[model samples]
Target chain A: EPEVTQTPSHQVTQMGQEVILRCVPISNHLYFYWYRQILGQKVEFLVSFYNNEISEKSEIFDDQFSVERPDGSNFTLKIRSTKLEDSAMYFCASTGTDQETQYFGPGTRLLVL
Target chain B: QKEVEQDPGPLSVPEGAIVSLNCTYSNSAFQYFMWYRQYSRKGPELLMYTYSSGNKEDGRFTAQVDKSSKYISLFIRDSQPSDSATYLCAMGGSSGNQFYFGTGTSLTVIP
Candidate 1:
């Protein structure tokens, strides 16, 4: 089955540095999303992208976070400046249609020290 | 109150046991319910999906949704050691694409 795939399975970055987590959602998917889970915490929604624009973003998706579908298959989340609390597993998901079940990628584990 | 609530269980069971996992939500608008399985340090894998208040079964797994009570459940039958994982409940509505997730229940099935 086709699945969402993410690059840089694990990343270590210094606080105040920048990091870009990349995902290649299923080719035919129209909606893409980013979510994060802190260690021992629930997954938190970050943002959703459709039509190459952000559809909705949560409060945690503040100034430092941005998402881009620079190409047809690539969806990326960039943290302009990382913080220690930013350490978590970032996941990318996609659904083929509105209200369809989303399929998730293996995730990119981000650790900022 | 949290949008979703799930018991963070470290529940242990013997192989062949039936495991029931559940979640409750405060949002009445939620129309889409899903159950995901996650191994430690990995992303969630979709296990079940339900559109509204109903029951859906896939192979040995069954999913139940009670929208009136705002509750959902995932049942695993004849569990195996490979079934050991953290199960998360997620839901969303037509209003937007964002989903609310539970803290996840950890289960261990011993063979």
Candidate 2:
């Protein structure tokens, strides 16, 4: 079955540096999302993208966070500046249609020191 | 209060036993309920999807949602050791694409 795939399975960055997490959602999917889970915490929604624009975003998706579908197949999340509290596992998900099941990627484990 | 609440159990059950996992949410607008399974060091895998307050069964797994009570459950019958994983409950609505998740319940099905 086709699945969402993310690049840089693991990343280590210094505090105040920038990081970009990339994902290639299923080719036919129309809706894309980004979520994060802090260690020992629940998964938190970050943002949702559709039609090459953001449909929704959470409070955690503040000034430092931005998402771009620079190409037809690539969805990228960029953190302009990483903070220590930003360490977490980021997952990318996609759904083929509205109100459909969202499939998740293996996730990118980000560590900011 | 948290929007979604789960037991966060590191529960252990013998193989062939029944497993019950549950979650509660504060939002009443949530119409799409789903269960996701995550193994150690892996992302969540979709297990069950329920559109409204009803019961849905697939193989050894059953998903139940009670919109009136704002509760949902996932039951695994005749559980196997391979069923060990953390189960998360997710909720979404039609108004937007945003989704919410509960703290996962970790289960260990031992042989």
Assign candidate 2 its CAPRI class.
Answer: medium
Query: Which digits, one per residue and each the tens of the lDDT, describe model 1 over residues B42-77?
Result: 889999999989999999999999999999999999
Task: Itemize residue pairs with steric clashes in candidate 2.
Answer: none
Q: For all candidates, state DockQ relative to the true structure.
A: 0.81, 0.80
Instruction: Compare the candidates by DockQ and give the number of the best one.
Output: 1
Candidate 2 runs further than 4 Å off = none
